[model samples]
Target: MRIESVHATPGVSGFYFDDQRAIKRGASQDGFAYEGDPVTEGFDAIRQAGEALLVEVELADGTVVRGDCAAVQYSGAGGRDPLFKAEEYAPVVEGPVADAVTGREAEEFLANAELLEELTVDGDRLHTAIRYGVSQALLAAAARARRTTMTDVVADELGTEPAAEPVPVFGQTGDDRYVNAEKMFVKGVPVLPHGLINAEEKIGSDGEALLEYVEWLVYRSRELGPEGYEPRLHVDVYGMIGELFGAPYDRDEVVDYFAALEDAAGDLPLQIEGPMDVGDREDQIDAMCDLRAGLADAGVDVDVVADEWCNTFEDVRAFVDAGAADVVQVKTPDLGSVHRSAQAVRYCEGTDTRAYLGGTCNETELSARACAHVALATDAAQVLAKPGMGFDEGFMIVENEMRRTVARRERDRSRAAEEVTAGD
Candidate 1:
């Protein structure tokens, strides 16, 4: 099937409740808040409306593939977006890639992995994002065309189905100390600390607040111990703790941080998100590697998860090749297409490293459904479904849809088996 059309739809919405004081309380204590303006940049306020991307691609057989692309702000110091802008690649979607895909075999479009990067000009993040949206739609269309579930397509491609066990879900709730962890515990999703330790004017440096925050987390974990739920807690440094400042912390300091987290979580498994910053690439990698080593030396059974530094398959390979991370956080859009993302997952198969299916806070139903397929397509250890805590209702809707899809697939399989047995 050749590519028939590539287009985007943009919408404005907010994820946070409209209570300003409550928002401030949460943001100040947790170091970040979901409330903010929709404009892509500038302004520090609770509840900013934001835009989402919807893409549609059609094939020669009149099959239509459609999905959403969510442009969300990364919730940390960098203030950099996750790079899902639609306008950045409007030309390619409306131009050459569109031309190359039109009337081509659907399989060929799916199989031609290099077309994404090749069609992209300047290798901008937007190109990758648009490609991701289109690819997801195509995968869904391909699944429908083959009368198969997206998971089956993935299983066929990967050569093995992912373990049937439900992957654990984790949420970054700013600071775990402020929220009722019991609510999340009841929902069966563990808590991950949003990487903001210092946002208050008098908080001095973030390091100081981070240390205190970790201590508080430990106390809360102990308090919840009697509830028969020893929930695991992880830290998302989000490119904060590293050896780049004038007075960089040594490996021991890094160990100390993990130790504090361990104590706080009652020795539960820890996952460190990232140490990636804009210009500190070398130092960040060194610090992360050293931090991993320190965790090993201290007998801390923790996993290092890469986010920013591992945006694509190449980055994922580089992280594993360098031994800088134990788990690679795979964001669907970051990898451009489910096909390419599946390849990255395959690359990690049979290795000690694990993959986590991460979420963008601004996702809609289309993107989330596609993401579920991608998750099922890979052997990821965990999946995060936080679409800004119910603001992006589509996120939750897609998750439910995925669950239903899985159930339907199983039912169909069972029916087929019964029919075969009756025939025999």
Candidate 2:
């Protein structure tokens, strides 16, 4: 079906736009410390209700489908900043942008959105925020047009079955986040631990500091939860490894650092993310490949994840093809289209690389839930639960969506089984 018209409006979100680069040095939430000393922590983040470009698409059949846009703060890891204002997204959804996209087939919506990004005068593309907002709107529209869920739409496009197990929920917290994680663990919720990108600056991205944080996470989960086991650890250095160990990366030093972390982590499986934000895509491939090789030489079993410069479909393939990372965090908004994100996941699946469908805490509830559908469809390594900078709200929202989605899938399967039995 063709889109008859597309309209946009101010939408509500359960998150905020935060510039961690500007956050002040102060501790909040569960005894975790924030040292913004390097960048001069001059500002504090306000957890205000965020805004989304809520798109309503009317199909030729006169049916309406709804979708919304949400983005991570920090300027899309610095690619495009639509300069999101409080009232609405900086890239207003209207005019020729809408006109160019209207009356297009739903399946063509993503490519058409890319065309809009390209056709913008002066070679400046629309902010990645707008791309995400618009493309997902079309995908949602496509799914509705087929009378199916977004997850089903993705499965059809990617030729994959929905994962039978509910997508594992990955949640991060420091300090008091333990209490929150403990509560969920007690209820048989398998909430995994994700340590922030070196938010503990006092230890200076040292392995010891991460060990302290992981210990707290493991101890709390084991002590409080029914399962007497440690949560798998994913530590996001956020490129602070460069701050600790200088660039022009020393292979031995890099291996040593991971070796230290491996010892500290003991038996817990360690997944390291953004150990270094190697500048160019070429450099990133080289550095990550060397690290991957170095870690193997040093007998470190760390899973290296690439996030920063790996922003697009091409970027993801480049990293995966080069065997540069164990997992690539498909930052949702950076893909410009959630469908492209699905393609990225499928691409990773087809290769040796693993996909971690992740966004930032800056995302809203709508985007997070939408990502839930994407994660379930692709069977990503794990989906980052977001919309909460702290441990509680975002975790609740994401886990609830997973549970609901699985329940729906189970009921569908049960009916299918019944039909077969009745026919027999």
Candidate 3:
């Protein structure tokens, strides 16, 4: 189907930084999570507003589609601001970005998506969010052309079908995470707790300290969590693992350390993400490879997840080729297009490595549900609940979206079967 017009509108979500790095770094005191403007102000609770751009596309065939692109909240080592990203890029989406897609076929717009990167409206490169918003809308429009759900469109493009069940949802754990962990575990949801290297205490400086923290995390989880729910104890180190050796990332120490943490985790499944922030794309890949090799050599069961610098289709493929990570965290916004994100999922599937459909708490309900559709279609290992970062809301939106997707796909399948029988 051909695109008729693309419209851009403002959207926002109430959210908090997954990690308030700037505020944490500036804090003169140790311990406690910091948030809010005048971030010098500290609060035990974290909640903020995240801005987004909603893209709606109308097709000549009379079908309408909508998608969302959310800003990054809690940036890592060096991350961009949500306001700056939204403000700087909105004009491009409504102007040149939309202009590029208008009057073109949906598939045609996607095939030439790269040209948008080169054809900047001003000096600024097309923002990632704009690319994501436009591509998502196109995907939805293509689904309309096929008279199927958005998940089906992604599945067709990936040469696959939606999964038999909803993708597993992984919940994020903040300062008040244990409280949520108990609730999530009771409900059988997996949790990725970041209290490991909180602003209150820096980990990785001491092997023993890291072990103790892991032990503490596990002990509390088991203590508070439901007995039958063997939820995954996924932890995100965010490069703190690199500091354990005081720099120059010692491969052997890292391996031994993860082995120890796995031991502490016992039967609970443990996956460590961004253990070491080595820097840049090349260095990150190399460092991850070294870590992965060391873990293999040590026969450690800990799965290493790559997030830093694994922001695009090419980056994910390179990491997969080099065997840099055991789990590839493909955040939707970073890849821009849902098509590219799906491609990353298929690439990881080709290898033994797993693909985790990840997005920040800075996303929106629209973005989360859209990504859930992609995850359902691509067979992603697990999909993260985001935009709100809270355990309950993110999980509910993503899980509900997948449930509806599966139901729609089943209905579509049954109709096709009945049509075939009628012809017979």
Q: Candidate 3 residues 153-217, lDDT tens each?
A: 77766688679899888887654555766667567776556443543255534756656766766
Which pairs clash (backbone N, Cα, C closer than 3 Å) in model 3?
A: 31-200, 204-244
Locate the minimum summed-lDDT window of 10 residues in model 3: 38-47
Could you give candidate 2's per-residue lDDT for residues 1-424 as a string of tens digits?
8888878777655555544443322333332333333231322432234556777778888887766666665442334354454344433567655777887887654466556556563356666667777777777777777766778877877788887777877776633445656655665445355556545453454546665666665556666767555566777777666556766467787788888777766777778888876567888788889889988887889889998788888889999999999989898877776877888898987687889998777667777878888899998888887876676777788888877878887887899999999999
Query: How would you encode candidate 1's per-residue C-alpha lDDT over 1-424 as one tens digit per residue?
Result: 4556666555432242222233324343224445434332333444445455566777667777776655444422222334333455455566666665555555543564446545645555335556666677666666766677777766775676754544555555633335634445444454454433323332225455555666665566556545655555666665455432224456676576666656555556566676434344455556668778878989877677777656667777876777777887776656666677777766777777787777565556677666676666564676666566542243345456567666877888899999999999
The candidates, ranked best first by lDDT, are: 3, 2, 1
- Tell me each candidate's TM-score: 0.78, 0.84, 0.86
Highest-TM-score candidate: 3
Ranking by TM-score: 3, 2, 1
Stretches of model 1 off by over 4 angstroms after superposition = 1-4, 12-49, 59-63, 75-88, 107-109, 112-114, 120-126, 174-177, 180-182, 190-228, 243-249, 275-282, 389-395
Model 1 TM: 0.78
The clash count of every prediction, one per candidate, is 15, 1, 2
